[model samples]
Target: MEQSTAASRPWLLLLCLAVAATGGVLQARAQLDSKGFISVDCGLPGKASYVDGGTKLSYVSDAGFIDDTAGANQNISGQYIRPQLSRRYHDVRSFPDGTRNCYTLRSLVSGRKYLVRAAFLYGDYDGLGRLPVFDLHLGVNYWQTVNVSTPGFEVTAEAIVVVPDDFVQVCLVNTGAGTPFISALELRPLKMKFYPQVNLMQGLVLDVRLNLGPADLTDIVRYPEDPHDRVWIPWADPKEWMEISTTKQVDSEYDDFEVPTAVMQTAVTPLNASMKLEITWDPVPQPHDLSPGYFIIMHFSELQLLPSNALREFDININGVRLSEAIRLVYLGVGVIFNEKPYQDGNYNISIKATANSTLPPILNALELFSIMSMTNFGTDSRDVSAMTTIKTKYHVEKNWMGDPCAPKTMAWEKLMCSYDTGIPPRIRSVNLSSSGLNGDISPSFADLKALQHLDLSNNNLTGTILDTLSQLPLLKILDLSGNQLSGSIPSGILKRIQDGSLNLRYDNNSNLCTNANSCRPAKMKSKLPIYVGAPIVIIVVIVSVALTLFCLLRRKTPGLMKNSVKPQNETRNDGDTSLGLETRRFTYNEIERITNNLQQVLGKGGFGYVYDGFLEDGTQVAVKIRSESSNQGDKEFLAEVQILTRIHHKNLVSLIGFCKDGVHMALVYEFMSEGTLQDHIEETEMQDA
Candidate 1:
């Protein structure tokens, strides 16, 4: 919503007289305790926090709530920083870098109601001398468009919402007309019983909240006066109504709304007691809202003491339709009434008429009107959101990955395709992370997105074998793993799907990868001679074997010299042989099972196999990575790792103590790291800092 222009009515000049008579009644009030309130000065410098002198509300810098690289902080032009203006309007946090910048408000109770307000005062902070228009969003749904028409005037938007998650995100979206900026953000926890029309499917955006009695133009009712901090603007219409007030405080102890005593004590009645009290207004719909509806609430109280045999009662009417039979006003008592549903009419006229049996005129103290904001868009599915979050964190994919991944359609994360079905949350259909600078093993988090159809991880530095879980995706149609350093044989389930023409797979340029078991095995040589030459071939083979036997006997006598000549060939062989001589100790399969207590405790799992917690004979803790039978990693890869570990020495690298190469079992044993993985440690540090 844009800034509203106040009407230059003639009766506004007489408001000061009415407020002057009652000003003394508001003094000597207790200080308001600022609990459950989040007040932020958007661009305040440094990490300092302070209380505002005027409101006594605590304000803090927005550094911890927003990303450092998302925006820049600057002060407004000095000429506009008037003494009467709030300190928050002197500076702004302007987003000139991205289309969507968001501030995350955490530690909110889900399903609880809250009042969120965003204020903007464009004092030409950029020194451009031009007003900017932008859109604001509450999470993934559109709240309103902020069109700043005046340079020094402040425009504020407020909404009462039932937060759907533990936290809520307030986002400023650039509409290309100008850069988006914000001066301050505030949140106030509200009682759940208030605003009965507000629900999970809809929110109430404040259109107007006015105190209908004569008061000073600058005297806004909030904070210590109202307790709930609801901003109540002073309204006057002396042409047809006259103000009536009492110095006695209005009792609102039993009321849920608890309208401030200052507001309820002063009220307006018809100038002629015989005439009806009427109010008319025409609401302008927001740009994003075509058929806006309104929910209105009116507060009333009897300010004066009445004698016996005198009764004050009125009937409330809206647009010529009667809303109630009759409302009786009790002396020094307050009552609040609101519509159960929203009114969709463009024009509204409220008439309060005295009942036939009443001897007094009707009275009204306060009114609040709000436009219904539909929150039907459920945004992205939770499962897809969680999985995408994991993938983004794992790969550090920062290409506009903010807020809801697939929400609003126009601002979906880059390289992602989402499906939006009517009445259902959006689902991620495709993800392309090609050449995104991703490294290490392929994250298993991708498999958690059940609705995902196409995945492209090609042209990255990813290693490890393709996970077998990829073949389990029911809707998966395309899988691309090309142009990487991935090794090992493809999973059989994937191969079956490929052969049936159900899934299109890509794995080109990976030199070490093989298609199947037969393709991965070494090729055997065949003789070209016929059966007639078999006898001569056997005789020649025998003669060569006899010469080799004599040479072996001579080599045994010079074992030291033979060892140097044969060791290089044994190390370089690519065949699936387990006889490679290594410095690390080798254990039998039974010994491995004994050390691991029959593989009872699993440390973790990966593409190769599960890692088990084990202990050596000397009570040294170790992690044993046992290869699975269906694992794509073969004997060659195992032998290569063993040789590399023996040759390398680094303080950061885990020490390989031994290995297992018994029968068909293959395992690697290394010193256990007491701390968790590097990813866990980094996440913990970030959470603490945040």
Candidate 2:
């Protein structure tokens, strides 16, 4: 476990601008909206068509252009991502496995300068507790290697690429450094002049796009309100800054894209804005004394409409250098944007103070910071991907089979092998199922793997006639089917293939199985199976006859005896034909009494009755819910509960084992919920609060 240090690690390539040769920052002011902008929320399956609240750019799920197979390793699900700037990052597709997973961005105009950005937020999503570093690629060309040293921050990689083809692909290649995953992917069409001064070949990296304001505020400014959905988040320290809003209309001196109007509406100033405002910007913490270059963009607007005579002036000082001598504030509606010279990481603090001539204190509406990176691999094959998916589903194999199966070569699924030679799509070369306790017939999908070489299914209860298709695999060299219940004549074609020395076969320990083509026989079953099944039923029938005879005699002496007799077994099954395959047993009154010791040892009580702790004959603890004698909805609730419990099953859920009903006396047994009642915890909290 090594911690990344400043000396050994790459300088977090923080982006866009640095102080020019003359010590002034480069200010990129505009962009003309074009027709070809594609936004993709990676790993999303459905067509999620919506607009981003931050950028106001409309994006759809990646399914329209790319199929499921192309997204071989999309794994992130059910994680609460932060910022929530846009819905795009909620469910990510990860690459816990696979050497490379590529997303092909189609319908792109060839020869256009496309601005592509890929975002990643680890959020410790995999719970591995370690961040991953991997390469990001554009088709066959190398883009940028995304190194996420910190968790919970959305790392974005951007580049200006000239698309040579109609469609450009973004690929993520795992370099055996860490498990790579992607949150959001964006492909926007850009006009030639989007980045005027920067070299097109050297890509710009996005470090931080912050909207410094109150931490408690979840308000993110995006499109419709601003026309361009540039997301602005609030990050002001509540104790230091005061949220101030102006009723006056704010106007964009330039385009709204230069300084978003939504952010300009509200501003954060020092708590005592009536006095001289002083702000010390907090510098991002670094691993060592080394300085990583960064870009900062500050947004400001005159919140108050001041008289022309009362001039509001301030100086921008960064690390002790003034941007200019004296700056005059525009009227209430007009906004101001400042792109500061890049600074090195240190005890650096950005301060903005009002001059003596200023009528009002300084106010900052929003600010953003970024780190730059340079430009990035292949996607996994389609056929092998489909075949592997079928095998897992058919066998119901529950393993960490997330992400692409082979790309990040080191993370291939357990008990599986893939071909890793170079440019060609990887194929499933081998599958090992030995000692995995497999049963039922072999999945026919296994035969679809054209490149399969070795197939092992030893030490299992698998049965069924061998499919001749097994011999159809042209590359199969090793076939092991030993220690299984597979019985039947081996296919003649397979037998010939085995005899001709083309197949290395193993078929031992299956006594009923016939190896030779001429001596085929049907599988024979154990001779004692019928006797073992019929003996118990015969004993139960004789006992039932004697009990019935005694019940009839007792009915003559007591008229109510026949009414108390247990309803016929068929009566329980006649509940409108909706058993739904629930594994419930019909317990008799005597059996319930034996298990619950006449309803002793009450665990708890509900509206129904006393819940008595009991155990099955196998010593499995259960809770016997005996209905209260005064309960009104006993029969209805019992039937309703039975119908529901039979359909639902979960680890946290208490399993309904069986039920007993003798006239009005109803009882239900459930697997114990050892965690105790939720109400108990609530009551304990109440007591502590009191």
Candidate 3:
């Protein structure tokens, strides 16, 4: 989840090595290395630049993050910086990317004697690139930053850090925290020599007791009767509290400390919303470990024990083009998602350039996004992403499933996917009508869709048998009939027929589906011997008997035995024969069917129908083309191939050997050629010459 290059890998690895070598608990201290380091001083025009106010940032991924405002006026004291990532802005000042946001900090001073510390409010748990931050409770990993200040200061006990004069990208990361919040940040001159050097500790310990509304919060409270009435103090005794720097402390008397709290709740008020846990600690006067620690005994309310998970969707957007269903987002700590889409609409430079004052390396994180027409929730159910895409492409439904559809382009209504069918007029490919409380049977007109692939009618008040007409589709892939009041036998016939025809059937939770023994009741029959045995035998017998009878009749009616017999094998035959013609075909349905073997091993399906991979007796590979009854152009293509191949003779054109003319079953059989079609060659070029 978190990636660090050898050069850009966090100093944590070096810190780990240091701890290992030290044996004892290595004290958090500041080290000064005069080695080559690039440092830029802010406010010197060319040296330090500012991201002017009103500059736009576009988040092009599910971890949507963007720069919403111009850089805060050089805040030397770190107070009241406008919210960039989490704070909502109207029109001109919207948060560009989703949470997991990042902002650039510039280095102001580029010299010794002055240690610069910078901090910002991090949301969605990671720093600029969605990287994790340190924990505030249970110890020392709460704040992360580099420090060149001298040792002897217990400054590493806070949630902020100080570093040298280098351009760095600081990301707020907390693997344990579900969401992130920051109230204030500070940057000041560090008096490193004044603090006493101590061994590095991973946790921060506070010792102050808070006056509660007649309750004890010394231990972890599970289901507390009144969480609102119960106030908590991290330290046990109030006397243990000392006057430390204001920037480092997390929580103090609200009257005293300038910290952000959840929308406040009165004492004894019903806890309707999930309470946000807030932890604040001292600041790091120097660089220290800022990994997430653990939570000690804390106070919480009892109304009920509620464990819930949040959902997050991740997408990728390369360059300016948006891909569809590209990224998978997962939560490391809560095991759920926090932010959804990362990219927002606008122009971006497509680079990771920092714009603030700090001493951290530039992070190489970019955004990617996928385009979805529409998405909807039917019930308390999670649908497969693939299944959802199929349904949308099937019903000719329309929606901008990914919220906003076009960027800097004309817009359509929400929940619509339109494809350019001809010269730009849109053809709807998907529709999501789940849980809209609609009542009716699915319109039979849906089967008219030749390009439809996905259809979802779950959790609705629809009633009807699975349409037999649907089986005629050559592209239909996913069908959801769950949570409906439809009564009928499972459409096992249709299922078995289309199992290999891009059809995925989902009919569970529909109680009316019958699996008993009866033709009227659709039996859930798996595709195997039984259905194959019955259907193929009848067709095979009829085709073979008809072929033999026709052959016998033709032989008797011919003028001579030699004339009725097969032609002598000749490699030196002329292109044109008076009776047979130059290009001719004489093949039986039985032969074509036998060669295709019940239409197995399909190469691909197009607007016509399935194309099967086959080989002649001579061991040359070929394509067996079949026309689907549902294809509007099926007959047209068959006739076109016959007419064109008869005249066209080139190395590129297929050499037609024969064709079949079964009733309503038109096919073309050509000399076996290993080379595939031009389209196939372009799509997969690595294959053997075709």
Best by TM-score: 1
**lDDT-based ranking:** 1, 2, 3
- For model 2, where is the 10-residue window of minimal lDDT? 526-535
What local lDDT score does residue 259 receive in model 3, on the 0 to 100 scale? 12
Error of 3 at 179 (Å): 28
How does model 3 fare in lDDT? 0.33
Segments in model 1 whose C-alpha atoms lie over 4 Å from true places? 1-36, 238-240, 246-249, 439-444, 463-474, 485-690
Winner on TM-score (1 vs 2): 1
What TM-score does candidate 3 get on C-alpha atoms? Answer: 0.20
For candidate 1, lDDT tens digit of each residue in 1-690? 111222111011101112222323434345446677889999998797888877788899999888666789999999899998999888999998778988988888989999999999999899998899999999888899899999998999999999877778899999998989999999988889878778889999998898877556578888878767888888878888888887775656566776777787678899765889988889777778777888778888777767887888887777776665578776666777777667777798988899888898899899898998888878788788879978887887767787788998988889999999998899999999999999988999898988989999999999888888988888898999989888776677776555444667777656565544433532121111111121223454564466457555645775553333222321322222334444566666776776666675576776678887665555444678899988997765665556555544444456677777665788877766544454454455688899
2 versus 3: better TM-score goes to: 2
**lDDT for residue 40 in candidate 2, whole number 0-100:** 80
Most accurate candidate by lDDT: 1
Q: Could you give candidate 3's per-residue lDDT for residues 1-690 as a string of tens digits? A: 223233122111000111112112223223323222221222122222222232111111111121223112221112222344212111011122232223223443432222222223322222233422332211112234322121111122222122222321223333343333232222233333311111122111222223212223242211121111111232222232211111111111211111111101101211111211122333223223232222112111111111343222222222323223322211110110111222222222221111222122111111111111111111100122233434444444433332112111223224444444332223445445666454556666656555556767678777767776777766667777778777665454554543334555666555554422142443233111110122223454565466457555645775463342223322122232224343555455565665554565565666667766544444333466777788786544464445445544444345665555555666666553333344443344445555
TM-score of each: 0.66, 0.43, 0.20
Q: What C-alpha lDDT, on a 0 to 100 scale, does residue 147 get in candidate 2?
A: 80
